[model samples]
Target: MAASNVAAPLSSQRPLAIEARGLVKDFDGTRAVDGVDISVPEGAIYGILGPNGAGKTTTLRMLLGIIDPDAGVRRVFGHDRPHEIGRLIGYLPEERGLYPAMKSVEAIAFMGALRGLPLAEGRKRGLELLERHDLGYAAERQIRQLSKGMAQTVQLLGTLVHRPRLVVLDEPFSGLDAINQGKLEGLIRTLADDGVTVIFSTHVIHHAERLCEGVAIIAGGKVPYAGSVEAARDRIPAQVRLETRMREGAWTHALPEDARREGDFFYFSLPETGVEPLLKTLIEGEAGILSLSIERAGLHDAFVAIAGEAAARQLEADQAGGGA
Candidate 1:
């Protein structure tokens, strides 16, 4: 699909938790982010998706005030200066770290402290959170003593310790096993259920597709599409899949011009005239319609269509390089 076709700005009635316009950033002499515009609705699970080296991190950093944009304007929770509202936001950068010697509960408390939560309250909340999430056993263990997934979970718990209104996680699913990934997904849902605006960056489309209501598709530092997932998928029509008893018949004429057969099944885009007329034509033409199914295109298909084959290949190559 052409970029223009999917470029319609997403409109939401909810107040925006984060908004940026024409965000441009440069590092040294290289342009890392160019003309990125993002709008995240309050309490929505939004996603920033791009392949590695596509400036996802740079864009996120600029929004969080860790780095300044060379050209752009951004407002976080209505504040012109994002850092001024640091206590109201929780961020987990791609580069993960902790004081390895600190116990899990203490580490969570320390992170909370950095965000202005008192030590005693942070520790109390940290223990309660750990116990609530079935991590009480690891609460007293030092970070170095836990498994990688356990440590990552600890860090994530720390991100939530202060109970910020917005949470930003960069490549959070990285280095997690399937079980832990499922747990993280549940945690994200729970956060959103509690009305937290959760925005996460990931190259993995499945993660975003399953959890995000809105998404920004960034490639080579440019946002080609940013809108509701439904709008993105609707760029292409729903697909029709059919199986007939016979491969050749008059019914074939009713099939779309682009329809193709693979063994016994034929597939094509759903006809604009509607399936009822097509079915009538097929039945009258003696087409043995064994079964039929029509389904909306998934986010994976939509991503390929919107971002183009080259961008899809870039994502595949990056995932392969990184062991995803």
Candidate 2:
């Protein structure tokens, strides 16, 4: 992990909203975020994606100033982080921040007030948000009385009541059912549409794929892939799988350059030449095609490929160091 000290002032040009250069954090002896460089343009819905123990939570904590990085510079809304974090950011931690004994309205209002909102205004916004999230009737209900999903909704409402410029959420969908997940995704989109910069971390790749305009995939505390979803998919190969009941010998010669057989199915890599010749050959061979479809690499595949490569490299390094 890189370490440096410069304590530079925030940028005068439209405050970055959030920026971290060579951010590094260590817990005990293990490095959590190692040399991470992240920049979120104002009003961009950026996603930080990684599997469990990928240091995503730690990175977000560093950004929020909940936890200090051992090294590197972090700024939130162009101000030195944590020092001015409350003024420009709203955070929803993975472990929901609510007092279980408190009523829904009280919990929401308390969170808003923590961000400097007056109690009366916080209560008004809390009630409105609760109603919007379909939990208005539960306003008087204690947090402990709510289901996990309902509590999650209240937590989200707390995060938004202040309407901070940048909202940072860590695994906001962890306890949500499909319906609640959809609801939260919609709300996130609405927030971004309202010109709020949203940065969130999630292990659920599909949600990130659907919600984020820009993404950074972190593995082993380092970003293996970062870009738009389309660009990430473009980094992988394109192939097509054709499943057929045709005789094995009949279409053997019609296979593409990188074709492979799995039982009755033929998985072929589409060559630059085109797929026309292969289709013609199969048709001429009188092959009974059960299904034929183009297979495009998805975000999940790209994530696995990149993370797998990083893990492999780490393994090799461990072995080399051991031998030395």
Candidate 3:
């Protein structure tokens, strides 16, 4: 079993909105999840990331109490069963559907009603949300009449109508275009800014990288890593990118032994001796430095390093297959 860092050092001080331990799930005779564990801090944007069929959705279902785990335990806002606090939690599942016959605002209201908001209040808030989101014109339109992106936005507004404290979104960016994806990302940030805890699952590393403070990397029904995004990224060394007009000089000797060259650019891990000596060498050796930057490894690079290239490849394949 792989070790799990269920919480980051900083998040450990905050109250947790969700926690799971030794979560196990089986489908027929196949073990789909094996001893998965995760911790989500209150009012944080967390991500559960994995390629398709890696048990991302299954783990989320278990957390939301949509399905019972075969073994282990989970708690949402201190409730063993999430449904007991359903109104305080909002979920937008991977399989999205709204009534094609119902008007957009009515649909949002109806969804709010399911979460315990009164119909009249839901309808009032539904319209307000639509207008606030620039979807006021679509309020009276039937769901089937709206574009896919518009309909998805309507569903999302419904998810927020009851002002849930914690929101779980499964593959929320799967079908969105670049523009709508940006919009969703902004909305997620807004929610977190308002002290709402947002947890989303995605195979797209960029989305998780940009939006999540913490993440759990699930693979083959197990968690390989679960902690701050920064921690995951730190597992790989910071990369130093150096571009110089002079291809070769005495300054080349100052580069890390493992440094690789492509044209006039050199890429390598930041040297243990640090960059000051390197800059001095380059300047004195007259190595015509055009650009120099040292950057932490991005989440994509970290994902490939931690989850392996096969999982990374599958993630790319899944995104390509989804056409988003």
The whole-model lDDT of each prediction reads 0.90, 0.78, 0.89
Error of 2 at 277 (Å): 7.9
Q: Pairing residues by index, what is the TM-score of model 1?
A: 0.95
Q: Estimate the lDDT of model 3.
A: 0.89
Using TM-score as the measure, what is the rank order of every candidate, best first? 1, 3, 2
What candidate 3 gets wrong by more than 4 Å, as runs, is 1-12, 243-252, 281-290
Instruction: Write out the backbone clash pairs for model 1.
Output: none
Off by over 4 Å in 2: 1-16, 242-255, 262-265, 272-292, 309-324
Better of 1 and 2 by lDDT: 1
Can you write out model 1's per-residue Cα lDDT over 178-282, one digit (the tens) per residue? 999999999999999999999999998889999999999988888889889889888889999999877888778878998999888999999888899999988
lDDT of 2 by residue, 1-324 (tens): 211211222122444677887889888899988887777777778888876677889999988888888999888877775656585678888877678899999888888898998889999999999888778899999999999999888888888888898899988877677899889889889988888989999777777788887777787887766656666665567788898776575677778768887887788777677778877888788887788888778877766566675544553443334321
Give, for candidate 2, the lowest lDDT window spanning 10 residues: 1-10
Name the regions of candidate 1 deviating beyond 4 angstroms: 1-5, 8-11, 246-249
TM-score of each: 0.95, 0.79, 0.92
Task: Please report, as a residue range, the 10-residue window in candidate 1 with the lowest summed lDDT.
Answer: 1-10
102: Cα error in model 2, Å: 2.4
Assess the local accuracy of residue 200 in candidate 1 as a C-alpha lDDT between 0 and 100.
96
**Cα lDDT tens digits for candidate 3, 128-237:** 99999999999999999999999999999999999999999988897899999999999999999999999999988889999999998877787878889999888878
